[model samples]
Target: MNTFERSGKHLAIQSWQKLNSKLFSGFTTREGGNSTMAFHSMNMGFHVNDDPDKVRKNRKLFSEDIGFPVENWIGSKQVHAENIVKVSKEDRGSGSLDFDTAIPDTDGLYTSDENILLTSLYADCVPLYFYAPNDNLIGLAHAGWKGTVAKIGPAMINIWQEKESVDVKSILAAIGPSIGHCCYEVDDRVINEVKVALDGDTVDTVYKKNAAGNYQLNLKKLNEILLLRAGVLPENIIVSDQCTSCQNDVFFSHRKDKGKTGRMMSYIGRKGD
Candidate 1:
């Protein structure tokens, strides 16, 4: 499946073509914004030391481009944990214009509330998108190595099943652009954690040891494995081949920029009819 289809400055989910047209889901690129310096142009994250006003302006531009209201956007203070929060109308605009008002320590946000956009920031971290069309639920998660080892993908699916009464089998999952295995080399600490998080066979499939003994971990494939284990259909999961670090011109990369980079925003929601 064509996971992400680039249209100008954003990458829309081509796999969602058969779904409701009003279900807006995509990730922003590092183009077409007003931020300066390290943030360059399209930085959508307010916590990355970019000018707040510039970040706000960028948000407005992105929201307008995606056909979603800027006031309807909600975000979180991502802590790289598996903490998924169920959002509602009351949570709208939480972290839209500022970072202080974001949901505390939340890396994933899911909602059945229409017209409320759920967003999370990312640089090299994987952006996991979930949709349960059967229940009109949408979810967005920031899955860095910490969150991935914590199995945040499966955690989101569990939340949907328990809180939203969503059937896991009906969930559609997408793993967005991040630092791919070609550039993501990790030491034993991360490798051990990944080994602990995933099954033995799956670990082999998602990780490989290099000559220096460092391991290359594929976060996207690991997340896909997590989704499959959580009962999502194999055919319903789409993994993007785009690597944020590899394509820094189109996206931001935390590692590639030595931790002083901006962030791209990943959002999913349904507009009001």
Candidate 2:
């Protein structure tokens, strides 16, 4: 079953939204915007060669559509690494308008602060949304292969546990849409890294040997395995089965578009209606 439901402009994580009325968590699609060609429309990443003005307008339209003001949004300068930054209201508007002001070298964001919308741009990368209701903590991590092998999801759980002095079992994680195993084949190099990252843990469910001798890796499941290893309860996790590559009309896939395509945004924030 799909964890996210379409709500006009974006896919809302209904389960998360239901857990906390003030919590706002969802992902944007490659639609309802002003961008053109290569980007086409709803391109949220300013560094993706899309028109700056158009990207800005797209941000404005999305923020208005979601009812989270443009000024309350924060973005990251994602380098495909596992750096997760904890933000607050004081850090609002950092990357809302341009890339230069975005939080540097960060692929994930967390906040106990309200009114600060944390966002990360994606094109087939796994968007990991985390929430610890005991502390009202919400977070997002951009998990591409690199970030996944680096264990960014577990890293976020560890940080939040430390941040709130709470048990990791209390954390709830949602694995959003990304390139699925059916569409993602990797060479021995990536497979080797996955093996090393798991530290000799079982990977039977994470990947498989395809007919071509290459491996079809499941990034979303890989992340879930790591989260389970990190102590997040099995029932506390939900994975989105929507493959960006398969659903090209609803999402923009880097692999599907041959590296030249628009980006979707994954966001989670704490704000009241």
Considering every candidate listed, which one attains the maximal lDDT? Answer: 2
Among these predictions, the greatest TM-score belongs to: 2
Model 1, residue pairs in steric clash: none
lDDT of 2 by residue, 1-273 (tens): 689899897899999889887888989999889998888789998988888999999999998998899999999899999998888888999999999999999998888888889999889999999988888788999999999999999899888777678688788899999999999999999999999989977678899999999999999989999999899999999989999999998899999999999899999998854
Deviation (Å) of 87 in candidate 1: 0.7
* TM-score, candidate number 2: 0.97
TM-score of 1: 0.97
Per-residue lDDT of candidate 1, residues 52-131 (tens digit): 99999999988888778888999999999999889899999999989999999999999888999999999999999999
Clashes of each: 0, 0
